[model samples]
Target: MTIPVKNTMDKKQAITAAIVVPLIICAAASVYFFVGSLEEEHEDNQTIVIVTIVPQQEFVEKVGGDKVRITVMVPPGASPHTYEPTPGIMKEVTKAEMYAKVGSGVEFENNLMEKIISNNRNMNIVDCSEGITKMGNDPHIWNSPVNAKIMVENICNGLVKIDPDNADYYTQNKDNYLEELDTLDKYIHHKLDGFSNRVFMTYHPSFGYFAKEYNLTQLAVEYGGKEPTPQVIQDSIDESTRYNLRYVFVAPQFAAEPCKTIARAIGGETASMDPLARNYTSNMKQIADSLALEFEE
Candidate 1:
């Protein structure tokens, strides 16, 4: 029997849909792949850098701008003195072209440098603490804006070494960031000047460089990287009494109970500070402002 005209048209329409549907799908897939490839190329063009702390990430960004990607080995809220990297983190390190180490005896770097270098033999090591005078074994050099300036310069140089084509771009950003740090130094000095009680107590001695730079004293409850002993706690309390210190500072990465103990003994309270913070400029200002209030003898 001969097929009806309407039935023939329906069969033809069905055949057309089968052909058009797959063509539409293939076009969408091609676009998706093209966009994905562009994204991968963009990321591959950027230099990979590994740093030990959040502040170093900040320093690298200020100097490297959009030309660098940073991986921080010591994650946020973890103590660099005690942090151990996971297998995943070590894998990330293998992709890095540079490792910007604090190199001022930061415990994390001291313990992991040998292994990190072994993992990525091609990774160029950048000593962010280059040319800075270390305070004995103290590694909290980034607390002082002056030291931060030096660290930023080191980071800028490292970025330039790996990505020379962007050297001018990195240098411009570094100069601008250095000016900001210099301004920060002046701001801290203005906030802290003329305060009678320049002694600030902390649970950890994370502000030693800061105190040294500002001509203040950091009375730490913890001594020698150990939790406070009764004698160390008493010593901090006695120093607080002697210096008329009204606050004991506690960091995000440390135990606050020890600092609180001293604060309670002195009839004072504890304050918040983060030595390994990400927002370097604002964090340092907040620290200076906090200390200025307690410095009112």
Candidate 2:
């Protein structure tokens, strides 16, 4: 061994190379598998959608379940009538695969539709209010559960078109949600049944569709998108008194002063109601509960 030092060193080098080469190859294989799995998981993530308002987002969630991510243009407690999307929100819209539009002449939708389409020309724009009958350009179609079912159907169709592979999944979810809507409708009917007063007063006329569905009358303080004049307010107060309205429904999105004044004039309390809440089913139920107060003995 002392006479062949160079040979001994060469043999050791050869052993080291043999060991290191296999280790490198094994490490490379592991890294490749890990990266592939990460890519697959990325692909499995939910599809992104852009909706006009919170209620539309709720509808999408009910129909799409965890398979979709929603970005709403009008946040909770914000009025869709005058919502303006920021630059960052527009950027978000560009990345979305679909836009679930209220599509019934919502002022926000009317103002931003062109820009929204331009941001993502390939994006599928689905009108959730497609089949509903309009109430003189009233865009609050989702206020009615029956109309909400139609919207969900439109949403499901849009989802199926975008992701045909998950058609069955989306369909099943839509069916389940529709059934829930039906149950909600029945519950609302039962709650409002046998009420002495079928009329309710609100500062904003967000419940036209709901009132129509339940065979009730909605008297609004604000008409034609303008604040009522003093005379008009007095007339509304007189009407409220005549109808024996117990509550003046005030939306959180608007100033409560007018509602409060009307409530004071009529000797009634102002109750808060949010038409733009993300919890669609619960909001509808709450509206029923509020209206039911008028009929209570």
Candidate number with greatest lDDT? 1
**What is the clash tally of candidate 2?**
0
**Least lDDT summed over 10 consecutive residues: which range in candidate 1?**
219-228
**Which segments of model 1 are wrong by more than 4 Å?**
1-10
Which residue pairs collide, candidate 2? none
Model 1 has an lDDT value of 0.90
**How do the residues 105-223 of candidate 2 rate in per-residue lDDT, one tens digit apiece?**
89998988998999899999999888888989788898999999999999999999998999999999999999999999999999997786798889899999999998999998896
| Model 2: ten consecutive residues of lowest lDDT | 39-48
Among the numbered candidates, top TM-score falls to 1
Candidate models: Cα lDDT each: 0.90, 0.89
- Candidate 1 per-residue lDDT over residues 29-55, each given as its tens digit: 999999999999999999999999998
TM-scores of all candidate predictions against the true structure: 0.94, 0.86
